[model samples]
Target chain A: MTFVAATGRAFLVLLEATGALAIFTASALSHSVRPPFYPRLILRQMVDIGYYSLPVVGLTALFTGMVLALQSYTGFARFQAEGAIATVVVLSVTRELGPVLGGLMVAGRIGAAMAAEIGTMRVTEQVDALTTLSTNPFKYLVAPRLIAGLTMLPLLVLVADVIGVFGGFLIGVYRLDFNPASYISRTWEYLEAVDVISGLVKAAVFGFLIALMGCYHGYRSRGGAQGVGTATTNSVVSASVLILVTNYLITGIFFSTK
Target chain B: MPDSTPSQPAATPKIRLRGVRKSFGPKHVLNGVDLDVGTGESLVIIGGSGTGKSVLLKCILGLLEPDGGRIEIDGEDTTHLRPRDRERVMRKFGMLFQGGALFDSLQVWENVAFGLIQGERMGRREAKDIALRKLAQVGLGKEVAELFPAELSGGMQKRVSLARSIATEPEIIFFDEPTTGLDPIMSDVINDLIVKCVRDLGATAVSITHDMASARKIADRIAMIHQGRIVWQGHASEIDRSGNAMVDQFVHGRADGPIQMEILHP
Candidate 1:
């Protein structure tokens, strides 16, 4: 009976958290579109979320592309299909690896930072101070982040896609001794618009979700240093999980053939 | 307990709370607190820690919604104002938080000018000038305005926070533990600055503190809260002779009294 009760209580907590998150998301989004928009704050967040994240995302894409090209060469060599390396590299990066890996990287970087910053504010009564100053915390804090995340993630992924495909090109020409022209040609020949578009769309969704989790956890954080630390961990963990889950769901929507 | 409300019977109190109650799940932080602060009156609430002092202040600030109560501001019921109306109501008030609560990301002057530039939509250059003036009002120099909150000492930060609170010239100001963690001399300095600032603006002031010195120095009227309710309130001069058991025990700082701390026995 105790075990049953514990399980029920756990479910209740999850249900309550989900409802709370839904309401928070709705409020943040609604506040984002309303009057009294802070373009300056949004621009600042854009720089933090987008500009600062470029190096890590770029390096991740470069290494992943290089490794992908070499690995694909090995696998396709078994079937005497070495020519398919370019197609596989470009398709995988644009369709799955680019958006998925970039989202996860950003979740670790920006999500944790957002949670820590806002959590500190929450614990120290800065959020309450904002309310007292006649400034809505949603508009001042959460909306700028939401706008930045939604707009910047797709841009990051777009850059990632280019860098990733180029990394594959480097490996194919320099290491694998393939004809550079033919490899480059094959990279684009099979790459349809849907593959890249679907990934960008996924990036947008992942970005918004990342910001939502960070802001929600940080805004609701209680206590002191310990509470802020917990919020930071929850922000990154929840964001990465949501990215993976939503990636699969969005891929199914875009690519599944019945 | 007799309250100071009788002294200001004719004017609507700047802030009035009747049976204000707040709780967090199993814990009842505020049972039913009733209090009043007269227009332009500096009222200081004194209480032991965890006796719902901060919670009571926050409920009035609308940061924490009370579970049940009637909160009135200038004779208007403000317990259930809509978001738009709440923002309008919030404009009339300013606060100096315990830790200063300065936005660490912004510069000292930016922190002071935040409400002016954001809430009132004042021009940045105009706001900056006012921010510097307010900083000077609190004994800070123009050079200090460019520095961040983290760079400032605790006393300087509190001064900057005071400047920020009065920058908008609010009609009412609230201070939460204005002297906690400060040295005795600095605490007294802050208490004096608070008194001067409130008097200069002719703003109603509500402050919560356990520091009796601060309460005495800054309050025209003093209220004592025990177990989530206001048990005694009168002129600040009469606090020492209140004769109430809780007030007597708390004012004298006696541990073995009617009010018990939840210390574990071996």
Candidate 2:
């Protein structure tokens, strides 16, 4: 009986959370299309979400690609398939590693900052002040963030894909003694447009999830400092998990065979 | 005289709340409160901590939805208004929050001009000029206009918040704990500024504070809330002579009275 009760409670919590997120998403999307658009606010968010995040996302992609190349060489050499390293590196980075890893890294950096800043505004009555001042908090705060995240993450993932493939190329040539020209040709030959396009689609979804989670948690935060801290942690954790889950689901849709 | 009777029917209330109720889970905060503020009247609500004064104000401000009841502004039923209608109604309001609640990211002038630019659709140059004048009204210099909220002291921040609230020359203003964390002198200074600002705007003002000095200085009439109900409300001068035990206890800062603090027993 207790097990049944606990399961029911968990299901109920999930349902409530889903409902809240759906409503928030609708509000954000609707407001983004409405007038009184704050171009300045949107541009500022773009800088915060997209430009400032370049170094961390770039480094993560570069290192992941390098390590992937080295590890694939070690394993494939045992199977007498060392020449497949370039194809594997390019495909994996463009289709999987680049968007997923970059999304997770950005979820940590930008998602957490959004939660902290918005949560502080919530606790301090600044949000309430916005309402009194005749500005819709959702339109003023959440819409710009959603717009920036929706547009910016794909750009970041595209850059990450290029940097990651470059990292793999350097490793294949310098460490594994592969001919640099053939390695480069093989990477380009196997890399279809679908691989890069699918990753970018996933990047867009991950971006939306990150911004939505941050704004949702922060807007609902109660108490004070402790609540803001909890919101920040929840934003990053939820966004990272959602990114991984959705990545798998999206991958299945793009690549699964009947 | 107390003037507790409803005003003449010809003069509609600037704000009217009838049987308004709000609750958070099982803890009922505002349980059917009824109050009215005449046009251009300054009404201050005084209560102990956690007595739902802020909740009451938020309900009227459209920041919180009441569980049940009607809130009328200038005889218009503002309860349960749609988003667009709510925004239309909110244009008449200005608020000075307890912690100042100034946007730390914006300079003081920008903070004052936020509503002017964002809500009124005024040009930046014109709004900044008006922001400067409002700052001057609050006794803040033009030098302070370029600084952020974090750079200013608490008193200065409060003054800046006061300036922002009055920047639009709103028809209604709400002050939430206008002197909570200030020293006595600063509190009195804020009280004086509030009184002057409300008078100068001829605005209907609703303020919630536990500061009796502030209440006395700014309020034409005062209401005391206990357990989500207005227990006693009268002219500010009649507060001491009202003969209500709860009002007396709260007004005199007494520990022993009908109103008991909930201290946990070991």
Candidate 3:
């Protein structure tokens, strides 16, 4: 690509991102302030998006943490720094991997599903029927997903944190032959409440991104079957990309050494 | 018999659209369209494929906002109602979707009761009772009520859609392509059911379709939409004397007429 063409493309992408962010901000504000709120709707979304999602998210987190420990043990053992294993696992989960990986997994699972469901509704005019029936599509459709996502992802990450730390614990206790008490103590010694809070904050933001991307693309989808499929693809891809990008930015804000 | 829809009181047009224009990029769908549907009247709008009949119906329903125009229902302007207000207006309507649009996650009874339970906030027991009653009105037995939409045949699904549309007993109902793809006999059966149920409720009916037979059987009056505008309209019998070439060509289903189909080749 030529310089000018690439620069123009980059600028266009930034503009698109800014527009999307603006829409997300507006909807979030609308959702929080809007009356006629349905507590039942929020609960239902929580059950659907959070409870039903537990098994898959659980499995992903358990394996990721175990693998992270195993990989770190091997890398640090070469430098005779294996005692730093707990520190490495805790920092990685708290700072980078937990929210990013959790968001990506849910993006693949929840984001694609949301887009497909909403996109199908859009195509079949169910969305219009909802509109005519005196229901806000944003409040009825988008809000539940956003609130569900904002809340559900944190719960998912909390589970991932436990299972992930446990996975590291199991590896350290059994395979690495590190003292279990020492490893546990090391994991908590320097772990401020800020670390856990930062991870959770990232989780909530990632959840919001997943739903925003999914709903925006799905609601705006045109054409027919092919269009729904494209919307689903875009939802997952954009959500996953945004999760990773936001993870870095958030990590810089929370844990920068200066 | 000009049976005034008693519910609307005949004081105002049930629906009015003035100079409504809609376009997608360069292709204009509705252009300076002006039309009115009388209270309690069954007005069937017939046009060929891509003639913007569906778009016009959607605009009236507030499903698609017209780029320029006013839409008033019962003398109250609805052209600029917010999402919530539009929904309130929508609650006054019932729609029989072209594809039935039943919720697959819900059972037949639940699909019918969706508006009652979800939109109207009716209790489940009452909603189901009303759903079953409406289902029976559409000739669907209670045995089919518990089944999901996927488990039913196309005819049964269409019947379920009809049942759902009338469940709330709204003042106005819109049917989009009521008999688009059903077999001839089945189509006639659905048409008859539509007439019977509509007359039973005394609801004002507006339907958009290309099915001349279906339109003839159900419409008390007929409006022919052509090129995003109403070309000729009159009583069902008067369609024969509309004298407008476009209306004649459409009623006769002729390819040779003032209307031209733009076939695009990529």
Each model's total of backbone clashes: 0, 0, 2
Cα lDDT for residue A221, candidate 3: 80
Between prediction 1 and prediction 2, the one with superior TM-score is 1
Could you give candidate 3's per-residue lDDT for residues B44-122 as a string of tens digits? 9998888899888888888788899888898888888876677778888988889887777679998898888878889
Question: Which stretches of model 1 miss by more than 4 angstroms?
Answer: B1-8
Query: Candidate 1 lDDT (Cα, whole model)?
Result: 0.93
Q: Write the per-residue lDDT of candidate 3 for residues A57-114, one digit (tens) a residue.
A: 7787788778988999889999999988898888778666778888888899889998
In model 2, which regions exceed 4 Å deviation?
Answer: A1-4, B1-10
Worst 10 residues of 2 chain B by lDDT: B1-10
User: Candidate 3: misplaced stretches above 4 Å?
Assistant: A1-21, A32-35, A38-41, B1-11, B263-266
> Fnat of the models, one by one?
0.87, 0.87, 0.55
Per-residue alpha-carbon lDDT of candidate 1 for residues B46-101, written as tens digits (9 for 90 to 100): 99999999999888888889999899999888888899998988999999999999
Two-chain complex of model 3, DockQ on C-alpha atoms against the true structure: 0.58
What is the TM-score of each candidate's chain B when compared with the real chain B?
0.97, 0.97, 0.94
Who wins the TM-score comparison? 1
Q: Which residue pairs clash in candidate 2?
A: none
